[model samples]
Target: MNGARGKRRFLLALCALAALLFGALGVWQVELPCQTLDLIERVDARVHAPSGPIPPRSSWPRINAKSDEYRHVLVRGRFLHDRETLVDALTERGAGFWVITPLRAAEGPILINRGFVPRGRASPSSREAGQVAGEVTVTGLLRLTEPGGRFLRPNDPAGNRWYSRDVAAIARARGLPGAAPFFIDADASANPGGLPVGGLTSYRLRKRLLDVALVIMTSPVTVPLTILGALLVRITMGAPVLFVQSRTGVSGQPFRMYKLRTMRPLAPSEALQATSAGDVRITRVGAWLRRFRIDELPQLLNVLKADMS
Candidate 1:
């Protein structure tokens, strides 16, 4: 009788533990989902659109030049010849470069992303063939200039290498003053064949698997074990299990963003040289680490570090 009673107690304790863990997982899921789009939406609410004609000259947004509030300006300007900068860009089509030309606006110089050109268009002939001349009207999304380069690589103006659409950097490199706080996303009608394939602006938020997984670890042991696994991976790899490269944030300022690294360290220029499944450049441990997202544990640190802000 005592044995059966003890067995019943054990079973009840197990059930209670299971219930507690599931409840904890459900709570976690409610907290840490992808909030990028949520933050974007909140920002969008604060930005009031321009009604009717452009606001008075003095009423324009102040240009410490570091806010997305300046985006979506409808400006009329002429392209400045010989001052165009080709920036490295990627698109759904393929990887290539962009033709960011300065548009001489009455108020200030606004950079216009003319369009995308493939690697084959890496010459003057290709640029000339696609150049649009004379007075023209362009209406596209105004993006705040991202000054620094992309993926932690600094923009080397001397080498003509650019990876981000930082207007201030480009303007400074081109030796132009009075540059606008933002750049325009050239519409499809402006340069259809241009690199980056203009009109590639639609962004949708997707539910991340990590968010789901974390939320499901409701069991007390499961949550702690998962967290322990993540911690173990981080301890094995050094401080940053997830690496945040300095990316050009809105309006030419620098911000660090997170990503999982699957490659061994190399010369800065040689970063992210693509590796297939069997590539030798990846460490055996890192490869397996990448597969299971043990490499991504550092992003929790990133999140705690408030790098996303």
Candidate 2:
């Protein structure tokens, strides 16, 4: 009788622990959507805040994506019209070219995406009125360097065809070694003839009701499974269970992507190697998680946050 009573108590305690774990998981899942909305609101506020002076030369070394990206800034410089590069862009006004001109600022050369121009007026001569020769003041948002090309289309410097505004590559191609590490997206303030439309930065909604429905139906099973997978990764791979990587999102925007850590750290060159099913860097638990697609469960949070679809 005592043995059966002890067994009953043991089972009850196990059930209680499981309930608490799942309860906490459910609360976390609910908080995720709220947190995502809060983040978006905060970023929107930052992007629209009163304009500030451009960071000086000394501050350039310290500037980073987390602190300075999308910052509204005012800069005084002269446009190097001869060195401008036109990058292909698709905007609300339709397909166009981004007029990226090098501005000779006090600190160094700064690339200003003056704005977008329709294909018909892509040449500097076509929009000559807007091309101010002397000193000019530009108000715009500071954007980070977009390395590599956009998606599968790489920037062909030799062909003078650029799919993305890769600052360093553009500088190298234009022979402007002193160009700033970042670029500025000029504000909606009008150009001389209004040829290139400024102030066109806008975010479009990509989420649909069907997407929310799918998340709702699958989350119950996936959430707890994710927790279990996290625990397993912690025990097997040790610290840093989650790996975050910068990924290009819709409209060529950059966003962080999160996933379960699945491989051992490697040097930069080695890390670039392609991996297959039997890659040796993959952890034992990671291999199992990857096999069942359990590693991607955390990205559901990204989808909830509207960073991904």
Candidate 3:
């Protein structure tokens, strides 16, 4: 039939586009999955090693989450108890505050995340014993500063309320002219007062290599299906056959997720927060795509693109 011939031609065009994309993006991404186990073992060795010297200020600018974050490091400094900031936290111990205090180290002032203190013991007076006044040695994991506040809730420096541990914001608020851009999460060396608990950081390394393998293995069926789906979307809807969504990835990085457009454009007055199942914005074609979960096919490309989430 004429319709079948059109579909074959459309598929060839889609294949050409995919080939161009692969050529541009460097498509052989299956190496990571094969090396994932080896990578995990290597990371474990580095993470569990004995405390080492903190990266000097000269090299701070070169520090990165990939090479330096979570490395065990040592620093000796006097705690500036008065300048300590408490950021809201929820740990295994329950809802509490992370006591982020400035340490006057020889290199410079660096923030030390003393640890979580329960809500009832959030006041400094309640955990007085842990607040050592004299010079002390802190041996713990070095952490990269989390800049922007947590999701939806931004830090209020004026009001002294912090939802996340932002280094620059805290430094400005506490009047530290020169402070390190990173912080240290103190190890679980028992504090005298036993209020703020340390060494509660969790390290979860995602294994996205298998995602690459899966996509490569299923490409035969998936490639054709994706092209077919795109064609269907174009015929059913109008222009802009793909819907792109912004999502958070590893270490608060933003990524664009691709999917076949299923819903009609929403009106300006519509709520952007949530879309209900019965919402009028859902087109008949979109409803069908949702029912069969065909809209997820395009995400196979996300796996190839170094982010599988």
Which numbered prediction scores highest in TM-score against the true structure? 3
Candidate 3 per-residue C-alpha lDDT over 215-282 given as tens digits, one digit per residue, 9 for 90 to 100: 76676567666766776788677678898998864424357889988887666776374878786787
Residue-wise C-alpha lDDT for candidate 1, range 200-278, written one tens digit per residue: 4422011232333343343344445444443443434444444567755322345666655555556777776766878
Ranking by lDDT: 2, 3, 1
Local accuracy of candidate 2 as per-residue lDDT tens digits, 23-105: 98788678865665554555566568998888988788788876787788899989999999999887667778999999999
**TM-score of each model, in listed order:** 0.56, 0.60, 0.67
Among these predictions, the greatest lDDT belongs to 2
> Which regions of candidate 3 are displaced past 4 Å?
1-12, 21-28, 31-42, 90-95, 118-120, 150-153, 204-231, 239-309
Q: What is the C-alpha lDDT of each candidate?
A: 0.59, 0.81, 0.79
Q: For model 3, what is the C-alpha lDDT against the true structure?
A: 0.79
- Which 10-residue span in candidate 2 carries the lowest summed lDDT? 202-211
lDDT of 1: 0.59
Ordered list by TM-score, greatest first = 3, 2, 1
Better of 1 and 3 by lDDT: 3
